[model samples]
Target: MSNLRVAIIGCGSIAQNRHLLEYEENKYVDIVAVCDIVEERAMVTAEAFGAKSYTDYEELFSKEEVDAVSVCLPNYLHAPVSIAALEAGAHVLCEKPMATSREEADQMIETAERNGKKLMIAHNQRFVASHEKARKLIAAGELGKIYSFRTTFGHGGPEGWSADGENSWFFKKDQAFIGAMGDLGVHKADLLRHVLGEEFVDVAGFIENNAKSEITVDDNAVCILRSESGIVGTLTASWAYNAGEDNSTVIYGEKGMLRLEDDPSYSLIAQYTSGETVKYELGQIQSNDEGGQTNTGVIDHFVEAIVEDKKPLIDGEEGKRSLEVILAALESGETRKITQLAK
Candidate 1:
């Protein structure tokens, strides 16, 4: 098989830290083009990878033939850019939150289907080592009859991680759609669904901008989610963790309890009802902090899926399903009512 020629849209932190590096490391991938509104950023990335640089994605598409693209643009641009890439005959691996609204997400999926292209969402949490191990354990009935969980993803804020620091579009409602929820919450939503192998059926929560005065978008959000099998849990996404990042999940079950990404030493710890304790050092979860550039397994999976002509684990439909939980939580926060997800 020939190498998969790839383009990266939006040379932001995600593109720089994850997609670009991962693609470069993949033997099956060729980084053929890079695009960013900021010409300097595009040029820098393109030079580093020995690829073409473009200020406009449309122009890049017109000139460069790409087998796949990573849509690392802002939240609002996810759907449109992904649809455009798919229509241009390239598989798309878009960043999380998928889109600002369900309608946009649906359109992205429809466009991918129409063009016969793969549309994968970069919900990297699902690819975390601890998360993968937990999913398997639960699937094997190790955590029998799961009852509850509390998953959280929090950090100081996007200013430190975004390309433009404090001036990044993440602080704007129009560009980001939602702040912590969209940036961080959607990750946990997708992770929970994958680990539990269930859909979230209901959501209720509060989303507020209490932590950041300069931002119009919410900086903190806490959601109560109920899965289809009656399992319930809380999901918290925050940008107010000034001390350190907290990306952890604790699951309670009839047979044992599982703690994931909670300990610095052990990535996963399992405690059984009969006095058995097990710990697995499955490496660390990737984070915004320095020395957190662990291989995410997302780019490799996307490349493999395209090369093998198979559906990605987190395809467009899966991405939309996770987005629905975030959207429902947003509605619940605004309306002060429990939002029931569509069946």
Candidate 2:
């Protein structure tokens, strides 16, 4: 088969760090065009990749007959841009939170389905080595009868990691929709669901913006999630971890417990009830810090799904399920009530 012609719709940090780099490395992909509202950013990225540059996504789509596109735009544009790409006869790998609302998520999914294009959400936590190992252990009953878990994704903030630094869209409520929850919390929601292989059925949360001044979005959020099998856990997302990042998860089970991305030396540690402790030295989880570049496995999977005509693991429906958890948490925070998810 000919190389898949790909376009990146945003010249943001995510596109530069993950989508553009990984796509360039993929033997089956040819980045045909790059687009951003900032013409200079698009030009630089396109020049680096030997692709065309466009200030407008619609113009890029109209001109370049791309086989796929990576939607790295702001939260508000994920649905519309991905839907447009799908309608234009291209598969889409959209960054999470897939959409601002469930309605928009549904629309994106519908558009993809109607156009027969793959719609994959880039929830990279699911692709982590330790996470994959943990999921397999749980599935094989190594962690028998999973009882509870706590997954957290926290860092100083997105300002340093964003293209615009302090003026990044990540700090704006209008552009980001939800702050820490959308940026980090949704990742845990998707990760938990992926590892547990169950949907979150209930959520009660507390969201606050006390850390960052002049921001209309939450900087810290904690959500209590109950999975479909009645397994309960806490998901915390914060932009106030000034000391360092804390991207870790601990799962408790009847057999024992599993520690993931918690230890500095080992990525996963399994402690059994019989006092047997086993450690797995899987690679570190990707972070926003310097020298944190790692193959996320998201782009490769998306490309493979398209090449093989198979649905991606984190498809539109899966992404929507994860987004619903964040939305429920938002509702819970506002109403001070435990929100029940629709099964």
Candidate 3:
């Protein structure tokens, strides 16, 4: 198939590191346009990728013959931009914590369904090799009778990640809607759901902004999640881990325990009840320092799905379900009660 002509809205850190860089590596994709509210940001990114630059996404949509688009905007703009792209006859791969609200997420999914276009959420954690192996093992029932698990994704803060640094839209309640949970926690929530192949039916979250008190959004969140089968676990997302980042998960089951991203030398370690320990060296997790080779498997999958006329792995419905779990946790934190999610 010919290269999928693509446009990217919002030239933020994620757009630059994940979307733009990945598209550059994918031979099936051609970066047709880049958009950002900041003129210079758009111009620089466009020049680097040899694409047109636009300050307004609407203008890009109207003038470009795009086959797909990546909606990498701030949390608040995810829904409308994705809906518009799908309406404009473009498949959309939107950055995650899909939208600020379920209502907006529902609208995006509906628009894609109506337009017969693909809508995939860029939840890259699921594509991690170690995570993928763990998922396959769990699905094969190697760790039978899954009992509990704890997942965490923490770092210094978004101040180091976003293009705008401390003044980025990530710190704004109106723009981000939520903070650590939306940023780091949602990734774990989605990862857990994908690995366990179970939905979180209940959630209780303790949300706070202790690390960055100046911000309106939470900088630390400790969440308790319960799966449909009664398995329980804790998920913590924080910006206060001053020493370094911790993106790890430990799963306990009847036959064995599995640890992912918990060791610097090994990506996964499984301890079986038979006293056998297995180590999996799946390479380092993708980060800004890792450069462009940190392939997330996102762009490839999205491109293949569009070309092969198949649904994306993390399609709109799947993303919305993971999003619902995070939203439920936020609600639980606000109401100081265990929140129930739809079955």
For residue 245, model 3's alpha carbon misses the true position, in angstroms, by: 0.9
Per-prediction TM-score:
0.99, 0.99, 0.98
Query: What residue pairs are clashing in model 2?
Result: none
Per-residue CA lDDT of candidate 3, range 109-171, in tens?
Answer: 899999999999999999999999999999999999999999999888888777999998889
Candidate 3 residue 159 C-alpha distance from true site, Å: 0.9
Q: Is candidate 2 or candidate 3 better by TM-score?
A: 2
Q: Write one digit per residue (lDDT tens) for candidate 2, span 1-343.
A: 9999999999989999999999999999999999999999999998999999999999888888999999999999999999899999999999999999999999999999899999999999999999999999999999789999998999999886889988889989999999999999999999999999889899999999999987889999999999889999899999999999999999999999999999999999999999999999998889889644688999999999999999999999999999999999999999999999999
In model 3, pairs of residues that clash are none
Which ten contiguous residues of candidate 3 have the minimum total lDDT?
284-293
Give the Cα-based TM-score of candidate 2 against the true structure.
0.99
